[model samples]
Target: MGGYGDVQMIDENGLRMDGRKPGDVRPITIETGVVPVADGSCRMVWGTNEAIVAVYGPMEAHPRKIQRQDRAVIDVAYNMAPFSTTDRIRPGFNRRSREISKVTKDALESVVLLELYPRSKIRVSIEIISAEAGTRCVGLTAASVALADAGIPMTDMVVSVASGKVNDVVVCDLNKEEDNYGEADLPMGVLPNTGELVFLQMDGDLSPEEFKQAWDYNVDAAMQVHKLMVEALKGGANS
Candidate 1:
């Protein structure tokens, strides 16, 4: 909880620091084909966090050993730009970025029909240009959009969201302040059409009921975000 002593994150009217209700998510916008050179690309902004994702390949798998005989492999690299946050991050792959990349690859691999392209690789690169909080979730969501834009066969798109407890109240999405000071965080990647989860992570403390509330919030938020994803893909096709 980062020693959030006596911090009042919610008002008497039950509104949060940014004037959002407990179940309200921050504003979100998504656009496709942001990287023209990539086979597929998307840019997504959730609150102040912005992530750009590019997809390349179903090309021959490198190193040969990484290739799968029956399906394609998904290689994901998630990175934060030096200027993305207040403190400049060193340029290189770190533990945090590696973990995020692995989880993101796992999430997308579940939905992508990799068997269609055996002995191949699909590369997903995620760049966080700006960060407020929940960059992992945003990156995963944008990667899903980018894959779709690339015309990859997939069973469903993955929608990621995080819900957390702040000041003993469960909120749908955590901004920078809430994430820094919140008591608990639960992030999940959901397949909206099937209501299945491809990713899940949590930290901090939460009672059983609070955990349930947070889970429900993430599920609902994923459905809402999935709508926007579909809309953005459709718009890209028309344009």
Candidate 2:
């Protein structure tokens, strides 16, 4: 949460500076099979954030000790290109990346039928080619699609969406500026088919009423994103 509310991001019509309504998400596009060598791959662009995710191997898990006898382990490595953001993040693991990766791996593991591939490793690579505000959400969403593209069995795909408070009003999908100055941010990973949640994170503060509104907004946005994920997979199957 940015926590500064002096800036006026909302206009007289209750529209954001980017002309989006409080409940409207930014434009998004999803595509599959972007990486030829990977077992599964997906490229997703949301607003100005772009994430390319690749899934590889239910291969033999190395270093016998880490191998699970009952279920496959998911290794997620999330990275941002140096040019992905204005700050030029270093091209290696950082605290933020590690945290996001662990959470993402946990969320995906909940939906994927890991028991089917015991003593194997499924690796998910998330590369942030560009970032606006919701790169974490984009990465998680794209990773789920990549996993599906690899023909992994899963109960449902995860749809990651975030809602934030800005100018004392709750809004769905914070843009760069809004995120920098917003009051609160709540990101959730939802299983659209079952309406179940696998990941949840929150920052800043929200009133009970405001929190409920944000949760509703995230669920609604997830449904909308799930539609796109399905279409992208179908398109890939045809192609």
Candidate 3:
């Protein structure tokens, strides 16, 4: 929750500030093989946010202390470039980046079949080239595509989306303006094929009914996004 002011984010037409009906997600485009040198890579643009993810290894888990004897570990580094936001983001690891990275790693771990590659490690690098809002969800979703592009084994691909309350109405995806003034945000990661959840996080409050609306919005949005992910992968390894 950023601001609780009486800023109207929904209009008389019952549409969001961005002219979307409450259940519409931001526009998205995903492309794979963006990083030629990496084992796999994907570039995703969601609304005004853009993220590039590169996956490397199942090679070797460096430093014996961090090595696992039976399964591979997923290492994620989520970073925002200096000019990622309107205000310059100071480069380097910060607390917020660390938390997002850890949560992303956790979500990926749930779907990736780590046991297939014993005692190895996979490194996922998430770079936010531009930001408006919901970068974390974008990063996680794009990372899954990068893993698939790299030919990794996974039980299912993850599709992440967020829904929130603004002006007493629940919207499918909050744009920059809505998020800055919204009171609640619920982000989720879904395994589209199985209808299973790999990740869920909430900030602020929602009544049970509001919560269900938001939840359904995310699930529906995930299924839609998953279709695009599959399309991108099918489109080939270029771009």
lDDT of 1 at 202: 93
lDDT of 3 by residue, 111-192 (tens): 9999998888999999999998899999999999999999999999999999999988999988898888898999999999
- Local error of candidate 1 at residue 130 (angstroms): 0.2
Please estimate how well model 2 matches the true structure, expressed as its whole-model Cα lDDT. Answer: 0.93
- Per-model C-alpha lDDT, please? 0.94, 0.93, 0.93
Stretches off by above 4 angstroms in model 2 are: 236-239
Q: Give per-residue lDDT, candidate 2, residue 23.
A: 99
Candidate 1 lDDT tens digits, 157-184: 9999999999999999899999999888
Count of residue pairs whose backbone atoms collide, per candidate = 0, 0, 0
Q: Which pairs of residues clash in candidate 2, taking residues 3 or more apart in a chain or in different chains?
A: none
Error of 2 at 136 (Å): 1.0
- Measured on C-alpha atoms, candidate 3 has an lDDT of 0.93
Name the regions of candidate 1 deviating beyond 4 angstroms.
Answer: 236-239
Candidate 3: where are CA atoms >4 Å away? 236-239
Encode model 2's per-residue lDDT on 1-239: one tens digit a residue. 66766899999999999999999999989999999999999999999999999999988998788799999999999998899998877776589989999999999999999999999999999999999998889999999999999999999999999998999999999899888999999999999988999999999889999999999999999999999899999994322
